[model samples]
Target: MPSNPYADLPAERSWRRAVVATPPFALDPTRPGDFRLSRTERIATAGSCFAQHVARVLRESGYTFYVAEPPRLAGSEAEDNFSARYGNIYTTRQLVQLFDRAFGAFTPRLTAWERPDGRFVDPFRPRMEPDGFASPEAVAAARDRHLAQVRTLFETLDTLVFTLGLTEGWRDRHDGAALPLAPGVVGGTWDPAEYGFVNAGVAEMVGDVTRFVDGLRGVNPRARVILTVSPVPLAMTYAERHVLVANAYSKAALRVVADEVAAARPDVFYFPSYEIVTAPTTVGRYFSENLRAVTPAGVAHVMRCFMAHAQEGDRAATAALDIRSEAMRTSQVICDEELLDA
Candidate 1:
């Protein structure tokens, strides 16, 4: 046999020799030359509930987890936990529409939804007001203010960490904007003719996200995006197929988009938190009993790997942060989709 270029490569490049051959604790999926974070970088998080974990880790590590709109409530509930109060942004179209609305380029047709008691909720973010706004005028005013803050988030942050949560979402037939949840699920009444389910394919995901990135960079040229897919499976699927089958399709499509988008842009990077938590190699120790929520151990392991490859100064600064007290706080994430379980 002739000696070829593959003769003397690092073991880390070979999955079998590096992962399967080594013990589970030794497995490290991240590679060198990946993007590194600086201690001063302003990182804004949006997307599914899983993104909340990233925000928490950033705060606890002494990194700048940019917050454009602080919560108005008091006590533990006050921490909305993301970069802003714009609840979970599950779809790329929703994120894009948010940018458009902030700049007054696009206005959704279904502005506010009314409840039986006559309270109104913004279609874009229903849960924002648990008791619901007093009227449609109030809903509009609140949404306008929220979008302004979201604009600040887009314009000021150095990095945006967005997690792709679902391929399926509900959208209005009129303006074609994505709604955070199906109308009836949270506040509004169900109007089958007015609302429809969307299972976005790879091309649509690519187009929507690409447009979102372009728009974001147009305002803030220095902003970069870090893409991630939520490893937690869907709480429920409206798709006619079995829940497991629908979930598989949803994740597969989103993962393809993640890979494609990251490859298309140099500034955009994909972090494999999804792979870390869901890989069969981990022996499924990362999931809770319900097999939906990620274990605290899993989150800690992921953050450790992320901080390891970060800038040296950032790593040292993060290490010196007061994490012991915050570590004692419970990890109870507020996910809208989890409502389906109820």
Candidate 2:
């Protein structure tokens, strides 16, 4: 054997790795600074399930993130109102389309039926509220209106946090546009060509995201982006006989896209929310109701991690300072209902 560097060398000085013991996975403890949320003066959110949770927590913690509130029908409960207003617009594709229409992605012209006089009208339910057109036509007009507002909206945002949820999506065969959901989920019958399966690869997803960010920057030069891969699995899969495999493929693709984009763009960053929830070390206690629902405890843990990071970024500043303080005060007043039963 060689001398082995004089047969003895002292151990290198390193912080002892603290194990974060929790359900779902254990994380080798990280310094708060290692995962700090950058100080974004303003923020916007879009994407799927995990995005909703992020928005909810940020709002509760007094962050000023832009969330579009839909019109509610009278006598509807909070959950019902949210469902009714947002059910049709859950995914990024849908949001992009919505904004495209608002920003005039397509030129809008009055249909033959929508003549000078209001007498002529769409025989079916009018898609546009102003006139009776098919849902498609209505969506087109709304998209134009949405585009008009995009410039103003983009100017106000400093950071846009988007959670990529699914790679497998349905597209209209005739025109080749992404459908918000399966045809039947919201309304309309499925046509084979009218809707076909599309499983986007990492390159395509990265291209789409880059284009979107670039377009937004064209309007607002100061905006930065934070991207995450949603940890939620598919509700259904187009891939034959293996939804789990499909989900794995989809998430892998999204993760690659996120990392690639972050690397390519100085203004872009990737958050590790997906890894925190799905890491194998924690033993999977984060899920609820047969691995679907993310438990309250899981959410709290995630929020704690997020807040700790955010706090480190700017120790003197807090989001929604007054509102968060008020909420804390209010929560203190409300006794734990669960403990009351005990």
Candidate 3:
């Protein structure tokens, strides 16, 4: 029998001796450059706030990427808060729902606004100017039409990069749909029977992600996946008397999922953004006032390391064909505040 090459190696130094080094902010504990993003590849991002930053960076860097926001409705009072106005993809449930909608597995929901005159309002009209969609039926039909567009968007994506945020989330009891945020905060309402608390474990998360990847592949075989765990800690926790414990649980579960996915699937790659921020060796000067918001400097350093590593791998892959060339690249480092403004 062959002996394990690392069996006699010192456990402490094993990781350091390995070819890939772990970055500071990684929650998944994966080494850097495990997966390389090609310059020609199309990328799409979803998941937490950090995911938005990744999307923005890729876009600014002249990469092909998609950031899908909710559709803008005419005359909506809370238009700014609407999902359509933001590129956030909401909940993990929504991610799966997008795939289902694309493959014709489920129908989209339509909602209508009612006016005092017992008539339907026009959703497309400005709220100050007129009543919204005239009737419930009309509103419902309009919703379905909007959902079709969303379906098309998902179908067009070549690679979906998702950053896992929180393991604890609210879910619907009747159908097991996950809510993006607490119902009252956004447009959705909360109900006892309709909503339940879900703290996903490592297995459940892996299952959710695996199913999502498989479903997407079923429709688009060339579609690839990249997963990252959010470094931001939970603002609050539902666990009994221990918010810290809850945060640990959430991050640990997400890390496990990333590892399992990377081990099981060749197409599924794990990115170490979480480690890039959290590494003890890296300067803590990059955190915001809250200590959780990774600073702009930190993000730039992380992305710089990532881009450099990716470029190296690309060069190595093409070097054998004598097509490698040294090229100069320029980039701007923006702070978190600047990112917010952008």
Candidate 4:
């Protein structure tokens, strides 16, 4: 072939050499990232349901897996769930709004949602408290404590790995703040006028993510961000279009947003967890029977790809963690979105 820009590229640049010809388990698609995780770095995680996998693996592999808000109560559900008590943060808008709420820039008017049984759930985290809080006053108190922990997470963590889960979500009509789940699905009554559905476009996703990173660095000057689009598909979609079509657009748009943001920022980088599990080379081996849940094999493959590039060569912390035992616990991940499973 005639020499050209493409001709001179390495074998890894070719689709056939890099993917088609490689064995599924041997495949490693992660590029050289701008940063690597040392065992001492305070690592934190947030984002959609799939993010629970990232959090668990980070903890199991002997990394810092920083949790700013530990379970204050003896038998709290937040043990391996959230860095702060905020449940699944499914959109970039939710992530940005979280920072604003933490720093006192915004306060949502709908602080609590009343369940049918007369209990109230925190609007920010509807599924967090089982049976809901005793009163809105109790909800407010818990939130005050939660946001305080969130502020600490923002200021102290060295790196935050945020998994972008979806572009479709519900938001408040007045302030346009994102809500984790749709009203009535888990708790709260759905009113047409109170809440509005938002399907974020590429520009909106990029803007929100950029705003989040800017807000994060303002508090912690040295904070680094690792952006990854969750490979898991949406459990459901609110759009009139079929769930399949909406999911395709949502993932594609978010992937572009991640690429654009990571490329523009020096300290921010995009990891390819999305690419690894969703790769065609896997031949659908990465998904469970439902075609939505990621199989343990898939999660392990993603972790292997991450360790190959992002983690430092430290086996000391790995000594205490039983990888097989941890794998069994993957089924216990608390995904708020799964409430729509009916």
Candidate 5:
């Protein structure tokens, strides 16, 4: 045998050479590339608020950021950032259930929830409609159209970049339908007897991810997925653990699930947005004053790493693109999770 297994490894294998010795700005965690992306491919994104950054990067880089679902009202920018009008999909359960709902395999009983002001909102997407629907029937009609668009998104999209966001969510006790927000956060009343909190363990998340990959392929076999864990920490937690502790478990569980799914198939791959932003090399400089929002510089660095691995040899990948201007271009990116703190 060799002098030691460690001695034969490259510089990347050494923590000091790979991370500590290198400047934080130069540290790139992404692999050469798991798959290739062309500007002509139809790319869709769905996940928590941080996923918006990925969509923004695609727009800035002149990629065909596909919007499978357009706004019902002309000139309305509500669905500007998301691929679909389903709003922010914060959990794997929500992701899988989305496919199920679109294909007519899963039907939820609790369709519309009444806001305190006598208007109804889709329980799965409470913050989507600020004024709420005129009636539950209107909500149902709108959801039917939304599901059809979601179907098109799954059927025609070439690539999907899904960011895993949360593990803790409230769900129906009877049928296990995933609720994007707790009942009372934005609308409806919190019924303890009817709904319950779920801090999904690793096994459950893995199963959810597997089903999502399998189900997406069922609709479009050529569809490849680029999974990433959102680096944004949880704003609040319903669990008994402290917010910091809860955030750690949530991120760790998601990272594990993304790796598990990505390892199983060549079509699914993991990106390191989580590692790049949260790396020790950065010394927490990526986060803003609140220690929550990722600074524009941090976002640009993440995009740089993304471009390097996406498809190489392009000057635009290394050249300084106007990231701030891109972010400002779609300043209307709406994140439903922000309502959780409200």
Candidate 6:
């Protein structure tokens, strides 16, 4: 036989044979990388709920997990796990819009959403304050303060880890700003004329995410990015097709786009948490009975892989950190998407 590249490849090529013959968690496919991390690096995490696990583990491991807007409310540390408290950023458009709003490049038209009791919430982050603010002025003041912190997060962090969650989202028709949740689902009134559904294709997501990373780098030239696709399926879909079919399409698109962007950018790298949890070898053990929430065991495995590949310094510094405690802290994570089921 000719001595081609395939002749020297590892057993993971024939790796599927073990999956077909053996049990779950047996065929690990995590690819090693040169994406190094030091204990001093200021790491920021965002994206779907799964990204919270990354931040939590980093914080608990004694790593510098950057937090620009620290929650002042008592008992809110666990809930405020991200670089900021922006809840599950599900789409690339939402991320870019966030950066734009932070820098005052974009201002959403639907500023405040009125509640039944006449109180108002920030339309961009309706759930940021669960009880709602006292008035429109209060909402505006709070949003401005939050945006200032988001600006700091973007400009100061050394590394940014973003998990691509969904391609489906709701956006404003006039301004093209992305909403975290649908207008009616959380606070604002639903107006078909004012709102539009968007299932961003590969090209759109790639463009938006690439622009975001490039913009971040422009402001902070030393920043590096790691992109991961959330293995958790969509909570719901607006597409006319069956939910299962829509989920497959959405996940597949995100996975492909993430790969492409990571490949195109020298500083951007892709991680395989999606594969670790969703692979057939795991036999669905990583998911909760609801099949959406990731199990603690699954989270630990993914983080283990990440730490193994990314962390290169002071490994012993975080070795004593308890994964159980980290898991407990993450259980308090607030995913805005779950409100869709409510």
Poorest stretch of ten by lDDT in candidate 2:
331-340
Number of the top lDDT candidate: 5
Ranking by lDDT: 5, 4, 6, 1, 3, 2
Q: What TM-score quantifies how close candidate 2 is to the native fold?
A: 0.69
Cα lDDT tens digits for candidate 6, 1-342: 659867766555665553565456444455655487877989999998889888888876777989888865755755667678677788999999899989988888877999877778888877778789888999888888999999999999999999999889999999888988898877889999999999989999999999998889888999999999998887888899998999999989999988899888878988889988997777788898999888887887787777767764446644634557655765687788888877
Clashing pairs in 1: none
lDDT of 4: 0.84
lDDT for 331 in candidate 4 is: 73
Question: How many steric clashes does model 2 contain?
Answer: 19
- Each model's TM-score? 0.92, 0.69, 0.70, 0.94, 0.95, 0.93
Compose the digit string of candidate 2's lDDT tens values, residues 148-254: 44545565677777778888777666555565455543245556755687887777777777777777777778888878777667767777768788888988888
Q: Model 5 TM-score? A: 0.95
Give the worst 10-residue stretch by lDDT in candidate 6: 312-321
Give each model's whole-structure lDDT: 0.81, 0.54, 0.57, 0.84, 0.86, 0.83
Candidate 2, residue 58: Cα displacement in angstroms equals: 1.3
lDDT of 6: 0.83
- Runs of candidate 2 with Cα error greater than 4 angstroms are 1-40, 68-99, 106-151, 313-342
Q: Candidate 1 lDDT, tens digit per residue, 190-229?
A: 8888889998989999998999998999999999998889
| lDDT (tens digit, per residue) of candidate 5 on 207-254 | 998998898998899999999998989988999989999999999999
lDDT of 4 by residue, 1-342 (tens): 758879878777899998888888878777765568888999999988777877877876777889898854544533465787788889999999999999999998888889888999998888777768999899999999999999999999999999999999998898897899888987788998989999999998899999989888889999999989998898888899999999999999989999999987778988888888889988898888989888887887777667656654545443434447655766777777777876
For candidate 5, list the clashing residue pairs, or say none: none
- Candidate 4 at residue 76, lDDT? 57
| Candidate 6 TM-score, C-alpha based | 0.93
